[model samples]
Target: MIIHVDAHIAYRFEEPTDFLLQMEAAAIPEQALSGPGLTTSASEHEAHISGEDAIGTRAWLRCEGDFTADYRITADIDRHLVDLDALNQLPPHQLPGATVPYLFDSRYCPADRFQSFVEAEFGELSGGARINAMVQWVADNFSYVPGSSNATTTALDSFVERQGICRDYAHVVCTMARASAIPARFVSCYAPDVTPQDFHAVAEVFLADKTGEPGSGAWHLVDATRMATAGEIVKIGVGRDAADVSFLTSYGIAQMQDKRISVTRG
Candidate 1:
């Protein structure tokens, strides 16, 4: 499928400030599944009138690409050796307990909440099954709601709120999988097919299956935001958390007044 995407973010500062710096992960990186065709980004800054000055910052991005992916069945469950290289490539500075078992203290921790749901639905299922179930469960229960939530809401908050946009949903799934001892990462990118183009987030879970051929591990892409099954191919930017890959930032006192995006696919 050929997809086209446009995203825009704007911030207006209450008071003029000295500096601004932000890391943009809006440009999607070519990944295991998808090919990139054409992509571009641009930004504009404006200073307000003389009386009491305010800083205004605006950014716009447009991306076009073709995505082709093949679906694969879930791999058999078994213990497989971890691939150190692949593991190392992941975002650093994640919550410390990620690779070890300990009481997860972060207010954002989703392990306990996911565990409760796993027990209620599929008792005694192995970690792999629990992860899969969580993926399926999120897809089943939630529908995407643009502008419903932002970066701060927790998984429990999302569950109770019952309505969220992409980031919240992805956080819910990623947090749950990591809590279950699965090495899950958060991804941000453009989904050209989604209406009202904007940044999107998804979850990728690392799996090991001893039953599979030697030296092979499995990866699963779960799209809680769209309730869509992600295949191998898609534009992606990965990070331990949203802060690591936020598309836009301003150091000055800028506040976003309006933003818009548009997407189309064929």
Candidate 2:
């Protein structure tokens, strides 16, 4: 599968502001950059860094006055698709060191608060089956309202309100999956079918590998909103929550003037 992406963002900064931006598709083994790859606006002062889990690239930029970024990329996706229901969940003791942290509570996804609820609602299932059910529950129970949530919204808030955007939906999925003893992390991605044509948020769950070796597992993408499937998602990065993978994070105030994103498949 080949996917093309184009995004433009314009913001006004009153004074010089430092920003961390992660807007490029990751070049993981499953996904290869093709064509001209990625092109972005160059800032006077900018440095590139490895994204969370070293899955992608991030840039630190210093800008003032009007700031704009134009990004374009083409990706060749060769993702390994699997049946979530057939995958087994690794116990905490069996999980890899890197995946262990995803099982704990995070700022946006407080897994601790969802333990009781997960136990009651998804007790009959285990591993990928449980996660599949939880994803469906979220999709069925929540409403997708664009402006219903803000940056401060957390999984608990979304759980109660049952309304929010992609990030909120992702937070809830991460929270519930972790509460069920599954190592789940948040993923920032792009997909061709996104309704609002914006950066997409999804969850990644670590499950036993197809090899079935003890303690062997791989991360798989799960989107409760059902907008895009794993094979079609172009992952940007992975983190415990959205805070670690925001497309743009400004140290100082930045007022948005215009933002446009387009993604298509060919």
Candidate 3:
């Protein structure tokens, strides 16, 4: 599948502010990108940097007064879909260095706190089966309330409230997977099928490869909200939590003036 994305963001900066923006779809092995690239009103102060694990690109910018950014991209997704249940969960000792970090707690996803819950609720299951069940539980029990959560909401909060947007669902899934001794990370992405047509978030779990080799594993995407199909997601980047992959992170105060995002199938 191919996806076309166009986004325009405008903001009012109270003073000179330094910002890190990760909006463009990642140029990973699974997704190929062909486009002119990001444009901004304050191009002089903009520079590009690599995203976490080098999965995508981020922009560093300094601006005052008013700022606007325009980005458009065409992404050809070549990701192969597989059965999550068929994949094995490798032991923590066998995990690669990069995957080990995802097994612990993070700010928005406190895996430590959910250990008991996960054990009681999903103790009977293991590997991808447990992950599948966890995702289903989230889908069945939660309500998709757009403004039900805020920037500070965590997975524990969402679990208790049983309502939130995609980000919250992702946090819950990540937390649960980590609690189950499965490595999981948060993903920032774009999906054409998402209602309201905004940025999307999902969870990526590290599992043993099809061959079930001891130290060979791969990351598989999972969406608890069911808004993003496995093969259709165009990832922006990944991090331990949303804080590391925010579309816009300002070092100083900034207010949103206007923002519009459109993603469609091409």
**TM-score of every model versus the real structure:** 0.60, 0.97, 0.98
**Candidate number with greatest lDDT:** 3
Off by over 4 Å in 2: 37-42
Task: Measure candidate 2: CA RMSD.
Answer: 1.1
Cα-based lDDT at residue 257, candidate 2: 91
Question: Residue 160: error of model 2 in Å?
Answer: 0.3
Question: Residue 127 deviation, candidate 3, in Å?
Answer: 0.9
Colliding pairs, model 2: none
lDDT of 2 by residue, 1-266 (tens): 98888888888889888998888889889988865544545555888899988999998998888888877888889998989999889878888899999999999998999999999999999999999999999999999999999999999999999999999999999999999989999999999898888999999999997787878999999999899888889999989999999999999999999889888997
RMSD of 1: 11.5
Candidate 2, number of clashes: 0
Query: Which is the better candidate, 1 or 3, if ranked by TM-score?
Result: 3
lDDT of 3 by residue, 81-195 (tens): 8898887789888999989889989999999999999999989988888999999999999999999999999999999999999999999999999999899999999898888
Q: What TM-score does prediction 3 earn?
A: 0.98
Give the 10-residue window scoring lowest on summed lDDT in candidate 2.
Answer: 35-44
Cα miss at 13, model 1 (Å)? 3.4
Model 2 scores a C-alpha lDDT of: 0.90
Worst 10 residues of 3 by lDDT: 36-45
Give Cα-based local distance difference scores for all models.
Answer: 0.49, 0.90, 0.92
> How many pairs of residues collide in each model?
5, 0, 0
Candidate 2: lDDT of 15? 89
